[model samples]
Target chain A: MTTTEAPAPSASVIARRLVSLHGLTRLVLFAGFWLVFAGNDPQSWIIGAPAVLLASWTAERLSRRRGRDVTLGGLLRYIPFFLWESILGGTDVAKRVMRPEVDIAPGLIEYKIRLTEPGARVFFLDSISLLPGTLSADYRDGIAYVHALDADEDLLDPLRRLELRVADLFGERLGGEPDA
Target chain B: MNILLDLLSVLLILAGAFFFIAGTVGLLRLPDLFTRLHALTKADNLGLGLIMLGCVRFAPDGLYIAKMLLLWLLIMASGATASHLIAKRALRGDGEDY
Candidate 1:
């Protein structure tokens, strides 16, 4: 039998390849997560290693189908804003509930989403519920039906701002106005 | 310094408890399921967050603080999701008054 000889790849080249591999990236991420959750205990690594591997493998398969990645820096910026909004939302509802008249003109507002990505669209819908006086009721065909505590309140502006923020988080620029 | 930290933690926890009570009041007093959901999510999230903040101040290690923060985040996500589902159901005529 004749053996074909090939040039050996350099160590740096091998490491670069491994780092770029999606499965390996996910494995490293899951392993880090395991370390954190296991409280950095070395003894727990025996159990954590297999569990993290399996979890990362499954997550890799699922993420491959979806194929979207969020910017962690963007997410970090979004959190404080989201927290403040949540506080405002809670306070607004509390005030309304405590008032004697309970003056609310509840109605459905149809909002047309301009974000093209499905992940961004879903996030937008979920986040709407956390905003003051708005709750997302249904989403279909690129349109989201939101229930407003006061129909007269100008929600579109805030919603648009939120859309832009979400777009920024996804490293995508939003184009065009949200349908009124 | 120790006494000051203790006082701050007590204040934070008390504030959190106040929000929890307010949320409960809103839940019982709100007219519709949708409005009630709004109160519950907002109040409870803030309440728990404040409590977690207090706990963070007392936590001996960074890891414990991180875990507490993680718990708060999980609670916020679950609360939002649960509110959405309930609102959706209410819209579907599960309750007409909402």
Candidate 2:
């Protein structure tokens, strides 16, 4: 019988791999998350120990195709911008809801993405859904199909800005201005 | 200082409640599923975030505040992912998956 499955990794190899930088980061993160969620009670550690290890292992396995690392400086800059954008988005919807007339000019805009990194692209799409007046409907090739609440409202600038922000976060370089 | 913090907390909570009401109203009155999803995700998250911020003033320790923020983050990520999936399915109009 032909053996199609690859041999299991040696225990030493597995040990070394588990202590690698990416794995270590996940371990620390999961451990910290457990601590925060379960508090410092010694009794909680009984469950938290195995849970943290399992969580870290699962996270590492699931993200095996991990994209480019995000820059801390980029994240620090992006957080405030993201928060402000979300607030604007929320208020915009609230105002429309409260208005005497329900005003919305919904239309789809084909926005070509500049960021090439997978993680960055996913984050940009998620942010678009939360940004003012825009929700990401689909993605094909390098273009994102965005649904705008108001087609008349300017959509390009904010999207372009967001693309640049995400690119920066992933330490990626874009070729030029967003499509005209 | 406590009194001032309490006043600010109350104001934030009130604003948060207003956004929650707006979300419900929009969900009921919006033209379609996509538009209503917008109301559900954005306004409700903002509402909860504001409420969390208000609660920060009353948190007994930094860890309590961290837990609250973490909860908000989880909700926000889930909301974004859920909205995207729903919007994608609606656009596709494939009920076979359902």
Candidate number of the best DockQ: 2
Chain B TM-score of model 2, please? 0.94
Q: For each candidate, what is chain B's TM-score? A: 0.89, 0.94
lDDT of 1 by residue, A56-168 (tens): 65554333233345688889988888989988887787778778877677888988888777677777877888888888776667778888888899989898888888887
Question: What CA root-mean-square deviation does each model show from the true structure?
Answer: 8.8, 4.5
Model 1: CA > 4 A from native: A1-29, A64-66, B93-98
Q: Give me the overall lDDT of model 2.
A: 0.84
Give interface RMSD, every candidate, in order: 1.6, 0.8
CAPRI quality band, candidate 1: medium
Candidate 1's interface RMSD, please? 1.6
lDDT by residue (A53-109, candidate 2, tens digit) is: 888665654453546788889999889998998899999999998899988978888
Models 1 onward score TM values of: 0.84, 0.91
Against the true chain A, what TM-score does chain A of candidate 1 give? 0.79
